[model samples]
Target: MLLPRGVPEAGRLAAFNALVRGDRATVCRAAEVPLLDQVDLLWANGWQPDDVLHHTRVALADAKQRRLVPDLVAADRAGRSTQAIDPRWQQQLDDAGLGDAQARRGWLARWSAREGLEGAQLVLAVLAVVETLRVPPLDFLLPPPGRPDQPLASAASAPDRADPVLVRVRRLLAKAESTEFEAEAATYTAKAQELITRHAIDAALLAANRGRNGEAPTMIRVRVDPPYADIKNVLLNVVAAATRCRVVVLGQVSMTAVMGTASDLAAVEALYTSLLVQGQHALAETARSAPPGARTRSASYRSAFWLAYADRLGERLREVTDHVVAGSTDSDRLLPALQSQADALDAWVTERFGTLGTSPVRGGWDAAGWTQGRLAGDTAKLATGDLRPTRRAIG
Candidate 1:
């Protein structure tokens, strides 16, 4: 089996030999394989029980200072048998002065209490800490003996106290309903602003614009400014509002575009509300169809309903297009007008919404056949129209 490029030859040979011997160490050693190379070798060479066991040991040993130890231990507890050490491996612990049942129990108790562990769970907890802690694995095996004569003072013995800064800040902000603990509040605010700026309101608008230009006839842009500057709630409310708004806007536009007037915007809003109600019904239908505990409620329903809504939106766009074409004073004028609306909508959505591919609502157009024809047609018409006015004035 292939090993990582920089892995020492001796290590590889030892791991390979251990695997051949059907030793657990070999599986642990193999787990030390770099993430990218590990899967390739496992699939390519058909990993055997020995290979898996050796790799697990190597992974545990090499996991010094990484979070992988906890995950590895958890995987072992979850019936991933690769992480099991040989029963004889416990003898090695005894050799290291960790063999005494009382010593093992003491160590397990101390480790678990410190890390909130319990029972056989202590094994995985200890292994996880050993795999990740900066100290040597043997340090856990050899703890400094406690001094019984000088009992340690506990926090319960301390006098009632409070930090001066916290007291001062609380008094200063008492009258200010909007103010919070300055340092902690600032940290949370900064994080919230980062997400908002990164997935800015404008950025989402840009993507919506692109989708509109491509083929989606109806789109909505909703801007929300909360009454209070609660940054945490702002992010949650904005994202939720945007999701609901997109569904409403797209549904409305599809129904109204054929009317050739802005009056459809209001009509579309009503239709959007109706669709949402219909969506609720559809969700119930889906839940009834699924077996109990066979699926997650929120995730499965949200995804299913969104997919259903997207299909409905696409069908409406086609229906609107057909209706407009049949009812138009000029068939040629109708296509150009629709194309223009689409381009303007795309640019607006992208500029206002944010970047493409960032939002889920932005990607369904490719599947709907709106990628090429209408965008090209719209651009060509706009360019020609701009030139016509200038040329006529010159003549």
Candidate 2:
């Protein structure tokens, strides 16, 4: 029987015969192998995780073809069985602290892809996972081939300045805010966001996975003007989270230091800038339409409206982000990488800010304005901030 260096050959022969005989239950015990041995055992048998599952499916199909349920074979060996492969897949998933299959797949695919597994290594990996899952026929649920993550901005992408995508989005937002017709403005701003997102994801996917150095972490400082700067920071958080960036508010100077790969920083920077412009316009429109009943508290009403709008926007952005991260195949690496990058950013921020603090925002609590703000936020140009761009924005 084929075996790797140092792998015991004692009961492996029985495990091998059991494998070929489609007696997974017998092999489960006879193989009595450590969970780690599962992959090596599969390799000795010239099988893969996909093959293991496929083999089971074929055997079941053949049995169904012959109109019979296959008989079970008990293990003839006394090998000690370790963790049950199938149930343990769920256990490893829980150990990783992921919520569901989609999220767990995201974590594994992303981290493994980052390491650039291929050929034999990749096959063994997927197979090792198969042993853990233990449900032979269920291997079809294994994750799809993972793609590398979006790289950090590098000199290759841009020449010591802003990315063209960022510039383009900024231009579109500027046009959107400056234009008179609401429909035309929405179209421009929406397109800008779509373009930037596409540019970021596409560039990451098309590049060679090996020897990629574009993931160097970096920072960008974004300005937040006062009179509701705290609220602005919340809005910035929305963009930052969506773009895979971490934000630190510079309380004293009304500035935000965003940290992430350059590609992400560009997206966060431009998206926040555009959103700020759109938000500014929306707030002004809401404030202008306020009736005289709250005349003395008009300023408070404006502040209230802004705060309320930020609250609504934050909720919406969080929902959108969660959905995207969960559903995306490309995000497997990004999901974990984001956490690591965030930790790095937190360390960087802590060194400077020491003890971070929050400011109290003044009134702007007009119910009418708050309602209008919710409507505005929900119907914003890029609704879920999804990966693909919408064909056109609603007027």
Candidate 3:
């Protein structure tokens, strides 16, 4: 049922139908080996559990097809010893809700039952996951589990979730995302950015003092959802810039490869996610209050709004970062460390993407929407005076 390459569409459909008519249990059992093999192969070839799951959700059409990727990933990881798995790998598994996969025996059967699949549906779901997993190798970003050289744990892991600074940042951003009042949201967001900036600087200084100057850049892909993915890419770029990271957007796959030190990468992802939500909310609110007969509902207006928001928000964030950096007492050591990371990251991006070209964003200009977006961004309360120093912002 794992449709081999070069099979004609008619032949494939016919084969599918024939299998649908056969004993489902036997077909499922037979497909399991190839499916799990494909999953393992993908992991070895630079795909991680979350990466595969995200791609499957985007590339596949059927709900059953989308739902099976993570289950298959869980099944594939069931035999691994906990000690052998990289912490980041395990984090991805847990994020994908597969942390207990090993503890659950006969997961496939249980997943089928839980999802209410039967007979043809079960067979088709298995085959769909198999087909989805069999893609070309991607750029190897991390050491896959089972590799002899895999670093099972490292300082690169995200700051502990329980860290008071991170906990406070998350809290502030949550309020920023959830609040309806623009001023209130902006205040919360500014503080969050302040905290993130301070945390990153602290991490950088710590790394510098530890003489970890040889650390190479690492990468992570953040998904860009559709309708205005191109505009969203602009927002991502701006956030990446302000957060001291770099990005290469592969628009075809709706993914952007972000390169930086581990801590900066984490900061970028967290802040970008919060800002995306806040931008979308502001856009929707604009749509509702737009003067009658305005083009606020048009694609051009929405695109222009996002463009302006990204432009303005980026300016504010850079100002905040600059203000904090200027306030740091350890500029002698801190500046060099930051400069080295940036230089190393630039080289890494050039080597990885080699001579990239710009991606043209779609949609015509909308003056009114652009104005509103800029205003909305300006309201984000990131004034230098308003930002609090988490111990001189970077001591």
Candidate 4:
């Protein structure tokens, strides 16, 4: 078994020794185990919560003083008021890295009681704080695992290659995105989205039955590229979610690492590239109408527009997904397999980042740009087909 970083020295060495019965261990320099798992290990080995907290606090206080992210994950049911935490703590809860879901909602509620931001609002804040920590991973006494070694799957062998329906779907979206009329665009986009959604789900079921052909869950980094990397990041995130994958922006690099099965990854890349093209075109049109002297304001509006577009895409996808799911007769079998696939992909994320962290975005909203972007987003489609009359693709 692979133990994550930051385990107590004695227990870690014991586990390391256990793996030495002639079988090699593939350790990671940065992978992390769950916080509760760490907590349990400590307790089982004669350490108590008070001892755990004391050690964690001491470690965290030092990290905080050094202006580094703390390697601590607070017990979920525990109170989170900083008055009791080290007075020297500088970073707010929302800005810090904490782990993914903790098991204790009650602890979160109690922590929020003193601050008066209870329920969902407070829970979100606590989560944000937890999202920021990057606990130091335990060192591999042996050797670390190698980097992603496989070459990119060839486009010829890729999932989209033989699927002509997907080819049509892509063309429809490309046409839909370029159209002048919102109604025409929406109808084309929706139909295109519908086609892709059905295809993806169908592919998933096929893969599930094929025992996934030895394809384990994997992560692929897709570059959002820059100029408006932030805007592109938002688009990438929405596409990942729409495709049943998860994405994490890899800080200032203009790229995101997406977690999904290989098939879903292909779907995400194909759909996102097309959507991004459409989005950029829409933004260009938004820019054309910018009145003189409001350049800065117009830029802000464009930012807000893309953000709203991303938000709308998420909603639109869920609506389409629900429609697809409801219409399926085999959902009892289909849903579980899809869910199992989702859970497996999510595990890869946990192993990689330990705790996920994302910062809030601000400043995208010019009244003109906001309206245009939102309207454009509503017209954009994923894998859902809602056909209305439409002008054909432009020259």
Candidate 5:
């Protein structure tokens, strides 16, 4: 039973007692039917394997519930033919460890034996997972994978494949995230920003030259988990802004829906991920030097620090993007193409999430932390130059 909110303790206990008295084997078998059905419903409603698993882990905060989800998803997917499965969708399933585990014929028994689950524990896990799968309709961020009428080729082919620009940028950002020295990290990050901005410009121009019938805009949901999720959302928002993307923060679910062309979305994801790593590192370093009296409010300090960092980095990244765009040899064409893309994307967002209300951020702030974070952001390198259009791109 999915416990409706605000159910009194006595009512809750009664439901639990009823479940406790049920025959365990029958319950498990019966539960699987609904669980598989819910998985199918969610897939159609735009919930992916990773998104559902993440919701279970964060919203439910139950390890048993989380463990049961992959098996349920994989088992449901087992019935679908390989040709019907999009490669990108398969990759998501693989990322969640659902690949190569589709042997669902005896999954219930195998899962029980593997986890040593039994009796009430097993029943609770099954029921919890079932309830978790009953997710409300979500906007189809990516095209639903198994739809017979939809074109899966575009979703499965070029967009999801490894693009050279992204591969190079990922390597640069990886160095930025791993390096200990602030200057070294900043240089790598700056280089990455330069590359991404240039690539975006080239892509836009190429699309324009091709009569603007290039890859259409799309969406991806990035998890902005808590321990200061609001501040982290700000960081993600800024990254999206600089990369010609828009983000709608779904604070209730600890997720952000980012909409953009595929390449730009990839850039935003990669850059935001690296920046978060760098921000956390800076937070730890600053924590070490905090005054003894101020240590009690570490949460406030971190919140302030990240907020300031996001604001400053937003300004810096935008500056780099502007500089690169201004220097483009094909600005006459590039500016209009970029503006047209932005307009189309704005219209799409308006249609998709009409009349969204702003969610107020709940947190404390520290002036000292803000100062430190601004300094960190100011010191971070973001160099860009020489944006002549490549012959290969335009030709």
Candidate 6:
């Protein structure tokens, strides 16, 4: 029996105060009467009912805006039966200085629309309509219950805690014994190969060219047009990180001595693998969703990809820094070495494209050209022994 419209300003203030003081019951009680009833009571005292109703609704809306409705009944009723008030409701209520439940409902509706919930609902509706028209029988039965949970046995409770396959490979690489290193390396190599093969298969499926050939295509081609260099930059960053890690690992420059931890090699390997996996996923998703004759522009996809990479990089950097700060002999020297690698990577990235600060598509190619010129000049200088001021200095 609560008024479906608004509440009075004085009444709303009182209600709001009551709610703040944990006296929700009082507010709810006052709110329960119809607006007309309250207005009629007021009219008996020579007050205009219409004016009172308008003021009341405004006050009610204001109270609602303050989240002063503490009574579970009112809260539940509002949450369940009402959407949100619209801007119009707010505009109307603003003059009266009250709140309107209908206005709140309208506002919620608008919010849902902005969030694309309405689009989702439309999609569901279309699917339902299609089902009704073409496959009526699908609506006849509910889906079966999901798999039931099983009771854990003692063995399950004490499950084997062997390291992940990748971790095992890293440990094997760290061993001084050639035989041990070879064995673990073989396993790790096989796993990496398998992952690559699986990724190829997925790419083939996504391309929808499965039956055309006995084997999947080795290289998946993508054409990203101008104005989308962000995508390429992000991809390049991932590749650069992986390549640097691999070089450091394969070079066998005593990571513990340089980076302060042999474990850093394993961490780097893990990061490389993750980056590769994520790249493959991104490529696959792009291939699947891209429209026919679509050329990539704006590099928005790559930008999105880099945001995730940046997050991972930040986390890994923190872990590495923490290890160094802990005084771990193998970890303490890693920060400077990593910084050097990062610098090299930045140089490579700049040479390949341009500065990270520049526009991805507009300035990218020009940057790449400039980088190439610099590299050529350096190479020529190196070849002519021009790097050293004196010939003896080089010796």
User: What is the TM-score ranking, best to worst?
Assistant: 5, 3, 4, 2, 1, 6
- Worst 10-residue lDDT window, candidate 3: 386-395
Per-residue accuracy of model 4 over 102-138 as CA lDDT, tens digit each: 4333232333333455333432342333333323222
Q: What does the lDDT read for residue 146 in candidate 5?
A: 61
Candidate 2 Cα lDDT to native: 0.49
By summed lDDT, which 10 consecutive residues of candidate 5 come out lowest? 386-395
Give the whole-model CA lDDT for all candidates, comma-separated: 0.30, 0.49, 0.76, 0.54, 0.75, 0.30
Best-first order by lDDT: 3, 5, 4, 2, 1, 6
Root-mean-square deviation of each candidate, in angstroms?
Answer: 24.4, 23.7, 4.6, 18.6, 5.0, 25.4
TM-score, each model?
0.25, 0.47, 0.80, 0.54, 0.84, 0.20
Best by TM-score: 5
Query: Residue 317 CA error for candidate 2 (Å)?
Result: 4.0
Candidate 4 lowest-lDDT run of ten: 138-147
The regions of model 6 sitting more than 4 angstroms off are 1-232, 235-274, 282-303, 310-314, 317-395
Cα lDDT tens digits for candidate 3, 1-395: 36667999998888777767766455666666777778778877777777787788887898866766667777777766553776777888877765235632466666676778867887777876776666766666567877858442232444456767767777777877877777777777778777778887887798799987645677778988887888899999998998888888864456888877666677778888999998988888877877776788888888889999999998888888887888899999999988877887788788877988896888779898899889888874566665544322221
Write down the worst ten-residue block by lDDT for model 2.
Answer: 68-77
lDDT of 6 by residue, 343-384 (tens): 544454344334434333222223332332222112111111
Best by lDDT: 3
